[model samples]
Target: MNPPFDRLLADVLACRHCEALLPEAPRPVLQCHPDARLLIAGQAPGRKAHAAGKPFADASGDRLRDWLGLDEETFYNPRRVATLPMGFCYPGSGRAGDLPPRPECAPRWRAALLDALPAVRMTLVIGQYALRWHLPGSGSVSEAVGNWRAYWPRPAPLPHPSPRNQLWLRRHPWFETDLLPALRAEVARLMEDPAA
Candidate 1:
């Protein structure tokens, strides 16, 4: 973390705007740096990630790492890869799964965080919420991801890597056959670039 990011991070961690409504106390989980070339814009933290105080600390993260063809070291390295969720804290669970990210998080904090990391070459927009935010009017996540080529060099929209999405994955073989490989290649290129 650079000086400005360090300060912003402190503020983010200290945030409690939704404390009264939150099931658990806020523990904003994220990784960032002044020199990150790639950003993973995911949904809110899950139970495990919230407990761990780290983004992508669960099975979903493991799958995402595989998709990017990245080892833990490279993926967790803040200078190379950054993880910023639409909602920084866990939004608690619902009947089906985790609830949507808190409505206030993105509007309050996203711009500041993005500004702190000026070297972001590309953002991996993961899950429905992030896709909606990054590629507005692009329709559902499936449609946005199916036409991922349209958003290249700026953002790459992807589905959530949670185990719950197994059915979607099974239905969309192209995601594995075509998109994953392309995503890996791009990630490699960006991560390998010294200038980035």
Candidate 2:
């Protein structure tokens, strides 16, 4: 029997509702297994990711993998972890970094995609947009991320893993000192568990 998730994914890939609004038409990109154990929810793709048709396929991916204590192979393995952005397509770049993801993508697809990944045990919400969407009423990004404990056993908020934010990382040493160890341990535990 084919799983309903296959159809759900197909529908997402075929989306073109925002085609005319985009500089480039939507190319929704994501990776997951119906039985994935972990989900990495992030902002929209950058130009590089859009071109590559892979999530986080640039320097940002390097930092993210370092944070997770994972290699590219492990991180991209759908059975182990899934990568689904709050918005899937690249939303074009601003003067600084990439523009915010298209608002339409999430409201249209997030719930359905999440519902399809029934085995997801943990969701790592990265960046302000993801934090806002997943952890509503949490106030500022710092406040929401600082209170990571509140979402224990399910979702964990994280700063965007972009080299562009290296200054932020340096200024907030406690993120590495206090959170990285625990985060790594939790990830290790999940990876080690056959049934996870």
Candidate 3:
């Protein structure tokens, strides 16, 4: 049988696998349940999300929620949706933005975590880092996101919802015009699935 959710969550909350390397104390921010139908596979938390101990607690999250056509209550409900970041802890800032998720995380924890979520019907693979690991050699974020049709029933790729990417969004009008509608439709379909 799979591990109980509370027990697994406690262990993950107490993890210190990257303690010595982290900029701050380890605070893994993710939510999951065996019955969830939707999974938001993202990169690590930003400073705001780290502070809140929740993934996607910033503008990026707001935009992401809008894209998925999900309200706060539904999106945050563990039974309805699960969130798993490539890196659980926040990887400090760099010259550009927050640094990439620590390489140690996904290899150490992803498979086990995924196994626990037996009912996940759709996973939204957000950002380049997540896309790299989940959809390797899948080309750039834009390319992967643009080819949303190919990753069906597995995980659909998406650009990070950060406001910093406004330029990219403006340039790639099809993302908003073409992709968001499909993403919302898929999410609605998954939420309505009785098997989920």
Inter-residue clash pairs, candidate 2: none
lDDT of 3 by residue, 1-196 (tens): 3457678777888989998988999999999888888999999999999999888999999999999999989889988989999999999999999999999999988988898888888888988889987889889998888788898757788888999989999999998888888889889888877663
Kindly list the per-residue Cα lDDT of model 2 for residues 42-102, writing each as its tens digit. Answer: 9988888899998999999988889889988889898889989988888887788788888
Q: Pick the candidate with the highest lDDT.
A: 1
Candidate 3 error regions (>4 Å) = 1-3
The better candidate by TM-score, 2 or 3, is 2
**What TM-score does candidate 1 get on C-alpha atoms?**
0.96
Ranking by lDDT: 1, 3, 2
Model 2, 154: alpha-carbon shift in Å?
Answer: 1.9
Query: Top model by TM-score, which number?
Result: 1
TM-score of each: 0.96, 0.95, 0.94
Candidate 1 per-residue C-alpha lDDT over 1-196 given as tens digits, one digit per residue, 9 for 90 to 100: 2677788988998999888778899899899988889999999999999999888999999999999999999988999999999999899998999999998999999989988988999999988888878888888999988999999757889999999999999999999999988999989999887774
Off by over 4 Å in 1: none
| Candidate 1 displacement at residue 78 in angstroms | 0.9
